[model samples]
Target: MMARPPLPLWLQDNLTLRLQDGLLSLPTSSNNSDDKNSSLTTTYNLISKRHVISSLVIPLLRHMRLKKEMSMRSKQNA
Candidate 1:
């Protein structure tokens, strides 16, 4: 099987940066009068792509960190 190409450095860095910075919880909105009034009256919609990616990526990165640490410790012990 062909090996998958590595992610571009910027993309990898972006994910890590977002993971560190924390994900957005509130729906983004414009400052326009119409938008403000509508937002106050209507329910805010979640940005599912960002939310889902953040959810999945955070845990995966954490697991990767733990795995790396374990490998380093095992090497030290050896």
Candidate 2:
């Protein structure tokens, strides 16, 4: 099987920059009238960020794992 080429340096840097920007843009705590409301908002933001990160990362991991398994199977068959 042919090996895949690495991503171009500029594209890799762009992806890294975008990921950092995404993380930096996640919601942070803010001042509010009610303590309970503020707490809820903070909690919601945290959960939302977790959900977003997992949603993006989990699929990518699954795809990588699947690719690895397929590669192994191909090698075994060969």
Candidate 3:
């Protein structure tokens, strides 16, 4: 497989901003039972680094990989 290209500066900046926003938006823990449940879910969604990585970054990497593979195949066929 060809070496993967580096992510564009703009994309890196966007992802950084998203991660920072997610971190900042993390819900604080609460004592009330109902609030606890909601906060747990919110924390899982907002604070888990894996959420952003899996949801946004992985798909982008997959798309980039597929594009590179297609280009390599085209070059080989030429």
Candidate 4:
């Protein structure tokens, strides 16, 4: 099969960078009235993401520590 010419490395990297940088950024309000609602939504979404990542990490760390302690105790008994 004939292969097509590859795009330049710089073009590929720029596309990926643009996608990564362009995510659900909080909306900005020029007036005071709309600011309250927009800000609350932004805060809620940010806090939820933080909570989710923390919940997953904490249990994994606890399990790892417990396993390490058990192995150490077993070695001492042997």
Residue 9, model 4, lDDT = 65
- Candidate 4 local Cα displacement, residue 40, angstroms: 2.2
Q: Best TM-score goes to which candidate?
A: 2
Candidate 1 Cα errors over 4 Å, as ranges:
5-46
**Order by TM-score, highest first:** 2, 4, 3, 1
Model 4, position 60, has a per-residue lDDT of: 57
Sorted by lDDT (best first), the order is: 3, 2, 1, 4
Q: Model 3: which ten-residue window has the lowest total lDDT?
A: 22-31
> Which candidate leads the pack in lDDT?
3
Error of 2 at 67 (Å): 0.4
After superposition, the stretches of candidate 4 with alpha carbons farther than 4 Å from their true spots are 1-37
Give me the runs in candidate 2 sitting further than 4 Å from their true place.
1-24, 29-36
Selected candidate, larger lDDT, 1 vs 4: 1
The TM-scores of all predictions, comma-separated, are: 0.42, 0.54, 0.45, 0.45
Task: Give the least accurate 10-residue stretch of model 1, judged by summed lDDT.
Answer: 40-49
lDDT tens digits, residue span 20-45, model 3: 77642555666667554776676576
Cα lDDT, all candidates: 0.63, 0.69, 0.72, 0.61
Model 2, residue pairs in steric clash: none
Q: Against the true structure, candidate 3 has what lDDT? A: 0.72
The candidate, 2 or 3, that scores higher on lDDT is: 3
